[model samples]
Target chain A: MPTKINIRIVTGVILLTVQVLMVIYARFDEARYFCWAPHDSQNEYAIFATVNDQTLTPDQIQKRYRIKQKGIDPRAIQHIKDIIERYETTYGKDSPAEVIMHYSTNGIEKPSWRWPKT
Target chain B: MSVNPLKIVNNEMEPQLLLTAKAVVLGLICGKYFFKLSDHFLPVWPIFDYLGPPHVFEAVLKVLFIFGCAGILFNCRVRLCCIILGLVFLITPLSSMVSYRNAKVFTGFLLFMIGLHKKGEVPWLVQAQVIILYLGAGINKLFEPDWQTGQYFEHWMHNIIKNPYYINATMLLPPMMLSKIMCWLTIAVEFIFPITLWRRFHVSFFLWTGVLFHGMALILSGDDFGVFSIAVLCSYFSFVKWPELIRVSFNGDNLLHRIAKGIVNVFGFDNHFVWQEQAGGPLVATINSQTHTGTLAFKKMVLYLPIFYLAVAVLISLAPTAALKSKCALLLYVLIFPLPEVIGYLKRKREKA
Candidate 1:
């Protein structure tokens, strides 16, 4: 007979197994069902790229940069550079990613100042 | 030469010590990823939809694997398990690149609890959780005057329950009384929860009161805090002899068994109750069955999924937090004896009443 400790061991195993299976299932489920958006026939992974120059906000800038790293858009590289240049003016040349992250998260309205025309 | 080999051997094979370590790692992994998954999947905040479906799915899988590993470690020898578990857990926060520092702090808290363990100590880990949460809650409330005054949280809860967008059928409860009871109880519970840990009251009384308080919250707030509270309650009984749950489960089964058997037969629900004709009408059926299924329907379900599924999600969300809190609270109560403790004084009033 397994001890109480043994039961906990079993519980742990069950929890981990369930989590792993759920992840696998959820991944397949998303890919199968909700991957596509109405805007595109192909599933467009979310990212912020070149926003037509005239339209720029810190929020969009930050969000685009995030998606850029996830391999969403290569074009976002220049825009990210532009945003970094603006941010570094006040935040210093070596303003870390943490500052950018913090600003993006806490600031209710991203610096864009206007709504994006979808 | 007097050799200390025996002492060294004794030090090495400490079973309880190993369990303490296991509990800490298990608790950390469970806390970190479970909450992370919830945040991604059924996010409390609507705005942060950044994780997207694929990343959310990945997170869920990570949580499952972490939980699986903890279970595997449980059956193994304690010392070896602890070493491996501890290392994995310590590395986890780093691996996850947790942006929210609360997750890291929560992990540290569990590790601290593990470090403080003495041989045959009451499961301090569980108790410490409650105390930390109570204090955290108290501090949070202190920051928000409306919560302390029973305005903001009460109004928020009232609106949430009264939301017509969610529950159209209202006869399940008397809304006015339920609302009042919920508001009053929440305020009272938050206020007195700290005092419940004081030594004056019998531990059983505190436990029972807590169970009732959370039970009310479960029913009233759609099982908001119920899950966590239940988990916390379980930690108290860790010292119970083996297979205690099985014994307790079957203990009063003669009457329950008969009633359950009778109900099962009467309802003809041996398998799941499959409706021949849509149980509620086409519209109802559409809402309950067709339009909403799986996580895609989770948002719709959250807004409206009868009562059971809503309760299940609420319970699931609260489960880990509650258990974590209870263990934490108990740990602190024993370790730190409050000076000029008013908690003892508060206990006598309840007993006399």
Candidate 2:
């Protein structure tokens, strides 16, 4: 085996080489941004509302309902449906167009929305 | 202070546990869940866009990844096993996205580097990786005004903050100013993570801080991140300096050093070897009269234990008819935790040779 120092130099060179490759890949090709930063969802997507057809203001919905544009699964759609139903039962017949879930795709600002699946 | 990462030698037994923990993660996640053809994916590389892991090949690659992780868990031809997985990732198109997370990529590189670092000492590259990750995260947080104001973590415990007086065992702070304080404290610690690499800093304090941070993350974060907190905590194993089981020097004995010596004596192997717990535990030390009074824990004569355990695990995995691959997993610790006697035997053999 090489001396630990020599081994470390080799490891350093390898790390440097891979980092170079990563930079090139990110710069030219489509690589995931290696920022190592956590996403701030709240500030980026500032819209928060409940919708039956027309968007309801924050007070009508009981729970905290923030409109996001991704992670559109069945459960979220159901949550939207439940919220809309709750609003109508208590406040008596708001716009019944539909409840929807919206979030950013890839947890970044690319807007998308999905209607609730009944 | 610029400290030499190469001089930071780890005990011979430390990497074994780290590798084992990584293997446990692989066995649980890749072996259990990631094998599904529909879900399994190799992150998108433009060159390989058209060539995804084909129908049957996908299954083969997943199997290889599982076995490769098993091979590493046991320390069998780890370099080769890691290369095999690397090849699988290269050849297969099982990734759901065009790219994987930076953490995944960093760990892949780490797996390769450690596989090559067969001598049991943690590589300087690994040290650099850990330090850089913390620094990068800290610097990123520093740029965010909200983090400076300690906004995110404060609201992270929203339920308790809303209630006038509420307390749960899990919720340590009642969503008060303490949340902001803890948030800033965490960021400060992370920013100074590089200081741990310096010779002046006490490694144990930072390591314990890391343990506490991850422990809190595990308890408080709920299930959002899955096993990520545990995984990061396990990576801390690479940084620990194991307790020296054989002593080579005549430095003035401190009380704890004396106690460490007593503990080694109680465990036997006292006749031919001296012991000290400088920081890490169960490191092999080679002693010779002509050489410096005692050799430090850089000896790699006994690293094959994990390989042997891996073989045992492989044998067990194959035999159990309704095999849950993890059945043989816990036995890895059983094989590694004991045996200064075995290390002594290896030392004697090296001397004879």
Candidate 3:
């Protein structure tokens, strides 16, 4: 019984600690895992990708990111950026692909992002 | 028997509430996966590109999740089921970032907490986890300038949801003022919920309020939030004071009585209700020593029965209109309390004709 009680207590503490840490981490991070901050931002973004001098269509962009080419991302715009970065630096590394994303957060237009930065 | 509110409130360790909570949480999780089975089987994100057909791994996890849910639902190897479901949810996000919902991770942690405890033990940790979720969300929103200033709410209403009611309200009042009022009210509720939920006196009040709050959120946002509202609402069962046993006596073995018995036998897995036939007596249900007759007794039975409660929840979730969904409690009240009596009356009239 004592061992069982101890296990419960330890599990409780660890879970609580991780949740708190995630909440704190959300302040600095955009992905916001376990933070419970839903619909925090309305990131209206459009992603344009050019590969071998041919611009990728909306369907192609959606296929690449597994998200719509242009839509409102409820999380931070940074998440969309991260996805693009991860894809570009990974399987698409061999291909000469340039990506640019124009995004607005909370109805306020922000600076556009360009991959393979100038 | 007389009902003792104090006794019910004081007995915080009722195992039935925990069981019901498990049923609800797992039920919602299963519904989500079942509805979107295809999405889970596919590895949509670039992160899984190097994993060489990550779909195979995802398929295995999803299969395990379904199996775990079945085990939990059937009340067989529940602890193991919780652990498996928890691990599946925890690891699912690794395959694809799109799968990483806060509610899913929260559910994972909650299941893990439940699994760590012994059977029939008070899920104090589960309760605490819910409290922490509210506290974390409230604090996060409290500090967020956009949430505080109504910018986020305005963006959500004007651009995202484009709620006609909000637009109409803006005609009479300034958009910022109306938005700020709604935002601050939400912030206040979320911020105060943690404190209120801790107090025994305030638990019921906040629980109902939380339901309404989440219900409204679901209505306003539609399904954009997925099962987050359902998950949180189900977790509120952790704080509920469930009756240990219900004693019901019927006048005689009529059609209604037989149907009631059938329901009790099928849905009452825990044997919470004990039904007795009493010749030439009024139909009555005794719970916590409190006796209720007529529609009230029927309502009490339905409310206490886990399957019925879950059915009502599923029905409410499927209600067509936002208005109907938002007024879930009232709808439930009508359905359970008076609608059955109305149906019985119609049936009797038809039989007479």
Please name the candidate that would achieve the greatest TM-score relative to the true structure.
3
Across A47-86, the per-residue lDDT of candidate 3 in tens digits comes to 9999999999999988876779998887767667767877
How good is the docking of model 3, by CAPRI class? medium
The residue ranges of model 2 lying beyond 4 angstroms of the native Cα positions read A1-32, A38-101, A104-118, B1-33, B36-43, B52-57, B86-95, B98-103, B120-122, B159-176, B198-200, B243-353
Question: Residue B211 in candidate 3 has what lDDT?
Answer: 67
Per-candidate clashes, comma-separated = 33, 22, 5
lDDT over C-alpha atoms for residue B148 of model 3: 81
Q: Once all C-alphas are superposed, what RMSD does model 1 give against the true structure?
A: 19.7
Give the CA lDDT, 0 to 100, for residue B154 in model 2.
53
Q: All models: lDDT? A: 0.34, 0.43, 0.69
Comparing 1 with 2 on lDDT, the higher-scoring candidate is 2
lDDT of 2 by residue, A1-118 (tens): 8545666457556664555454344334322234344332122222334454466554543323222322322111223333334443433344433444344322234443333335
- Lowest-sum lDDT 10-residue window in model 1 chain B: B242-251
Best by DockQ: 3
Instruction: Give candidate 3 regions above 4 Å deviation.
Output: A1-5, B1-53, B249-269, B276-297, B316-353
Taking chain B only, the TM-score of every model is 0.41, 0.55, 0.74
lDDT of 2 by residue, B1-353 (tens): 11111111223234443444443335335323344323232233334334544455466767887777665544455566665654454333224332233434444544554555545555555566566656656655565555666565554444322322222522675544565675688788877776775442867567656755654443344221322333444455466543333343323345544553454444332133453344433333453322221222322222222234234323332433322222332233333332444566598899999
Any idea what lDDT model 2 has? 0.43
lDDT of 3 by residue, B136-168 (tens): 878777887888888888888888888887878
